[model samples]
Target: MINSVSIVPDFFQRVKTISFPEVIRVFYDEEPRRSKIHCPFHEEKTPSFHIYENGFFCFSCGEKGDSIDFIVKLYNLRPINAAKLIAERFGLPVSNGPLSRQDMLRLARAKAERLREKRLKEAFDNWARLAGQQVRILAEAIRLQLEEKGLDIEEDLLPLVHELPRLEWWANILAEGTGEEKLELFRNKDFRRWFTCKN
Candidate 1:
């Protein structure tokens, strides 16, 4: 089955990144670079077709093009359909279709924003996990030092000992707080200073 839709240059460029040598292995057990095959375009006994990362070429027939062109010629399909097929095969999601230049630009911007948000969320999640663990470790270390020194705690650690309750509160926020709560914690100068110093 083939999907019929016009493709933009951006879409074409994305699809072109698929390596021809790797794609050929889907059909042939032999690695394309290591083993040459008979020319698909011309009748040749000795293997003259060579697959490369960016493209392939048949020395016998002088047929040459990138991965997209390979699919286009192989299936006798239009460029857009070939691109859609290749993208689907590799699990790349393609939106239905583009209507106009302005529409395409809008779609591209929206896609970029979605990617940005996804990365931000991932980074924030990782930071929260690490922050929760780090605060607890620092508090435990301070508690051990407090035990060793009795009432006469080190001057450097006395501040942390004083702040232990707040650190516990911060740890709880890191573990289960809402995004706004986390944002406010980051905005607090004390929390920022302590987090940076401990890290």
Candidate 2:
């Protein structure tokens, strides 16, 4: 059964970030700032679980979250889990959690997601600008290297030479191929040689 008032501090104060593994540790160990609890996600002893002031990582079963997310994941649960848990523990009738409280959480989550997406977009914008400059520099350097080596440069590769794909696309592409294929696509050996020789 969960406590009526959270023994941990307010969610905001408890952690700046949260992760599953750390929460698991808080559940297990008697950390000074965090509490020891049985990791609900897995079987264990001696409380290898932990939760940060902000509810970050867990050392066991890799269950983690912010206070809310922690609770959700802890139960192998969903957004509705808290409401249900509270209802069950307190012997109250379950009615879709509390409407007002759940709505507030939904709002907070929506706002947070928007902010995260905006921040990510901004970061990508910055990376795009930097990549533009980097691509130019790389292109120029590559051109010079090719020229010095008396190698023919492909005229069609200007775009590819100038900018890396966006991070999302890059991730997708990297994940799309097999290890050997990805290594080949990335020209990993060439990069390694370049880095080693440059140093």
Which predicted model would earn the best lDDT?
1
Task: Estimate the lDDT of model 2.
Answer: 0.46
lDDT of 2 by residue, 84-180 (tens): 5433332333432344765566656755765675686566445444433444455566556556654355766544444333323334434443334
True-structure Cα RMSD, model 2: 15.0
List residue ranges in candidate 2 displaced over 4 A.
1-99, 144-199
TM-score of 2: 0.26
Per-model TM-score, in order, reads 0.45, 0.26
lDDT, candidate 1, 1-199, per-residue tens: 2343344576777777767764564434443324467767778777889877788888889999988788888788898888878766654556545356765665567557656766886787787778778888887788788889988887877878988888888989887776668768767898877776221
How much RMSD separates candidate 1 from the native structure? 15.5
Highest TM-score: give the candidate number. 1
lDDT of 2 at 116: 75
- Model 1's lDDT to the true fold? 0.72
